[model samples]
Target: MHSTIFSLLVLKVSSGSAMKLRSRFQPEAVGSYRRLLCSLAASTHSVEESSMKSTITKKSIKSEILRSKSPTRSPIAVLQDWIKSGHKVTISELRFISLQLQKSKRYHHALEIMKWMEAQKGFQISSADHATRIELILKVQGLTEAEEYFSQIRGTANQKAASLPLLHGYVKERAVEKAESLMMKLNELGLLVSPHPFNEMMKLYMATSQYDKVPAVIMQMKQNRIPTNILSFNLWMNACGEVSGVAAVEAIYREIMNNGNVEVGWSTLCTLANVYVKAGLVEKAVLVLKNAEKKLNTSKHLGYFFLITMYVSINNKEGVIRVWEACKSVSGRMTCGNYMCMLSCLVKLGDLVEAEKVFVEWESNCKNYDVRVSNVLLAAYVRNGLMEKAEAFHVYVLEKGGCPNYKTWEILMEGWVRSQDMEKAIDAMKKSFAMMKGCHWRPSEAILMSIVEYYEKHGNFQHANHLIRMIHHFGLASLPLYKVLLRMHINAQRPAFNILKMMVKDKIEMNGETSACFSSLCKRESARE
Candidate 1:
């Protein structure tokens, strides 16, 4: 009977195609049909042979999808190509591909896969699939489209599951009014059984600086007879510290200890320690952190990161060193993030000697050459006015295969500007601009003004004009840029009319200094005529 049922499900999955099954059953089964197929794939010899063939096909499809350099390539096109090549495309394989893309932060590709699945003739998208699609939409298309998609699924089974991601999107965006309306609706629909929704509300409140509302959210959770989890208590404790004081936060911690409903972990202890530190209770904070250390899960690096950071907050150098050594003693090799955290903490304490030691250790053991890790040390060097060391390290990083990101160039540009190496600074600025293309990074106004001042001081008309054009390209044109440009053009005996026209086009109101520069330019041009 089981064999017959499995065969029927497998047939349904294959769409009754006589073509050879070229896709292996994914280990994680999403629905009943896939689950039955997975179990049967493991039992029989003929099934095992088919599964092996399927594994190769799945690998081929995944490799093809991931190998495409263009993010805009259609996943549906890839799927169709596989189908044309005699490879059977299963829903589970599509889901697995979508999940892999999501894990790679390729939201556009993942959404394309979700859209392809939706267009399939016979396949039914479940409520859970709708929820996943809503989240992908939120990521790729933004909140408005996600809300529109949510509205279309209303009054259906997908509505309830789909509402959670929409609520989360509102919370993430800090849309207080919309979030409250959705929470009330969820409550009315009796979908507020778990503490997850309440926790989200509390998180939103905390983010908006309305700490007083956090406890109210916790109360609502209790009133609904929902059990508070570790995260709920953690947020509640943080809110208490903000609204009330250390006394109130400690009271919440005591209640958690006595209630025994939620399992207390290192995170809760870390929160309590943080409150204690903020209240200037250093000794108490240290005691709590020691206990947190006792409960710390050594397998996870985040716990050690928190401990090291808290120790740095207290200026407990000994404690920092202890935690660093403990993290190193863990079984697996330390991650790049772990090394970055340690280097950051050491640098914060102004212990460059130890920071250099940790940086060297990271370079020796790191599998991937992450410039961010090198950036921590580079920033420390630049901060200390060690220009020689900073320049040397920058060259060494390039030689060692470290690609300088925007932050790296920004740091070097600042240092060069400080040291009055205008040529080097300008070169660094251009590199930083190139790296910032397709991203949202912008040079700080202070840095831009410094470069503008450099041009004005030297009367470099050509470069100043070029720099202003670059600034305009970045949508960062301002009165200062126009003022400098007018001064340079007037000094160069060029027509200042175009500069004045640009000012008008940019809608920059002429201030006192700008009017003076404009008047000077007009007088110069009049005399030249």
Candidate 2:
């Protein structure tokens, strides 16, 4: 009896011939099947509605956060408003928002979202979320704080997952000792079940120039029966290239091709090609690059950029143009990064005309003006001693509503300094300093010294004093600057006592030249008295 009902249901669903099923089955069975069909249809509609709602919710939340006036604005406030507006916040939505923030490099905002999630009642934060929060804390705060947070949750079931980010942080900082100690601890805890931790250790070893240790890492992986990933093989190939040569890299490549567990990727082939290029085996490099091109994922631009860079390194202009055209063909509308890469390669190859054409294409299609894109051409102009063109391009950028970044002013300052236009150089330098204030950037000592020499030669005491104060404000004051100041004071027959006091305060050591300058000033003062 049950089989008869099941057959009737299948016939109704497959053939949708309800009259035939009705003729075979009892009226009661047909009525039950109708109810089931209604239930299934409702369930599918409900799922589609939920999916649509989820997509809309994600878009709304992302827009709210991105539209905030400042990066420091609390994302929690956005969530509160979202909740107050008769909307529910799901864990999935919050996680989605956090991931988006992370991709945009807004770590502080991402951390705020994580904190909000932890505070919510009945929301079970997964181990992966905890790991993400730890990584965000490492970025927003420091490694010390991240380590402290990890210590509190070190004994949890998913401690292995939580610890990987910390290990990555250590590798990023090149803290070899801490990384090795953590690896030892993880091994003792039996948490080294995957290739991630081992790959990170290999990366650390390579970064610290301990190339010989890379093979030991691979051997350990083998002994532990941990399968290697694409990154593992790439790093191994690079370390081999660094330590041994092209032969060693090729051997590893052959092994990778044979290892069914690992899929040979475009990036792996690119790494091998790079090794070949370094060894001056252009023919071999070209062959590997062709293989890499075959493996290229058409959706991604990274491989194309890497190929262009390799071609540039080998002075293969035709190869660059071919890959570039291929990239454009695949990507109907190119990105700013794509244009910049092509422009830079063309400029490097002394194909300024082609560079200009590419720049114009970017300018025409770009929604918002990116000064960096223009800066490439501006720099090329300045680098080749075309100051007039550089100056004109700088004005053109301003006219096009492009804001100059620190690098723009830096290039202009360097060009002006080279032309011995001290006044313009000083102006550009001041602008550069202003742009670089509170940033990690510092002007090169060579440029600073050149400006100092200019000031000293012209006996420009006022500007020299201002420059010294600016340098001191930026914590860039050096012995050379103080020495130049002392000489200027001595030459101007002004009192050098205050300058001497500043040197003492700054703990600038008195070298032979400095001492001699001070002595000359002292003797002249005595004569005047």
Candidate 3:
């Protein structure tokens, strides 16, 4: 069926302009194709692949793990492998694969997939599909780069597709003004940008702690005649809860229930339960949680997941296991999001043993070896000050040909720095920078400060100066950096006048305090020299 649902597109040049026609595939054909992909994915993986751990030979274990783990394979690498092999690849297959990578948060590979698709023949992109590609750009290149990309939309892309997702990106970053501007554009274009973006705007307000502004967004939605869903109420309740406390949240819940304009979903019930718990109404909270669980629609995998996390919030282990096992029985295979929620719940409860078990199960079943899952456990270990465990897992990941992302390295270094293990902290810091080579990863301010502080605390001014020099070489200048370098020259009793000249060359203005300090320090250094 996958082989049968080929999307055929014919590109035409009219008036020396390229025109795109949407590829058509029947609903039944798409359903069949999805089924085929599922079956193929299931068949390619064996249930007992890693189960025979101790009994397997070293060579066999390496072979099996390399084939199954694939933790380091980029999306482009997958395509390149196919292309180099001269394997026939369909546009639909590439599209599906790109979507999978995107969902997995492998944006680098996903973008490469889209670029590859763009260059291929008969790869038609509709406005709808193009919307997703724009989101891919936002994820891969970040907000500033994505803005540049949106500014330069060409070809058959319905520009609105790019703009709408950019609005969502702005909301994600809590850029209220940008979100408002983009929303206005959507309204002007009459593009029918769905309620999801509005909901996101409310979320942004909540994140920024602008609780008072939330109601204004809701009022705007109503004035525009956009229907508000239960989630809108849930976020609205969160805002009300934050500002006016439990009493306000309770009153709002009652008002919403009595008004009857919106359907009271299970999430609404959970919100009430949360507020009840906050109010110390344990019996009422329990009753509402029971009602929420009772309202679970078994067909939807998300409801069960929500219930599990809710139970976790209440620290009800029995309820968590109950919902988890039941969901697994029905959903067949657990998604990474589900596992992320479950693992995070366990971590929040401080049940490291249970978290480790879930992580093992996740690793055994996970495709692409998503490092995020490992990072979750790493975060827990680092949070608990269990640096040994974190280092063990970090080494294990590297040995398996997997690279830890920037956050992973930061966590490890932060832990080492906390323990005042400067050697290990520097090692971790170097590894983080090493991993960033030819990648978009940037050194975070916190990590940079930790290294700088450690070096300064130990009177290693020369090393700190070298670090600042590297930062300047990267075209990044911080205000306090010049002061540190100046101090370093004085400490080393070196040619302080040369550093003063370098500062002048870099156009760092000398305030009175800086000038006096530099003049005094340079005289002392010259005397010592």
Top TM-score model: 1
Model 3 misplaced stretches (Cα beyond 4 Å): 1-263, 277-283, 308-319, 437-450, 453-462, 474-484, 497-516, 524-529
Residue-wise lDDT of candidate 2 within 399-448, one digit each (tens)?
99999888888899889999988789888898889877667878887788
Question: For residues 226-295, what per-residue lDDT tens digits would candidate 3 score against the true structure?
Answer: 7776667777676665555667777778878886677666777777777676557777877887787777
Q: What is the C-alpha RMSD of each candidate to the true structure, in Å?
A: 12.3, 16.6, 13.9
Error of 3 at 110 (Å): 15
Each candidate's number of clashing pairs is 3, 0, 0
Error of 1 at 315 (Å): 1.7
Candidate 3 structure, TM-score to reference: 0.57
lDDT of 2 at 234: 80
Candidates sorted on TM-score, descending: 1, 2, 3
Report, for every candidate in turn, its global Cα lDDT versus the true structure: 0.77, 0.77, 0.65
Worst 10 residues of 3 by lDDT: 1-10
Collision pairs in model 3: none
Give stretches of model 1 more than 4 Å off: 1-69, 77-88, 119-121, 154-157
Distance (Å) between predicted and true CA of 410, model 1? 2.1
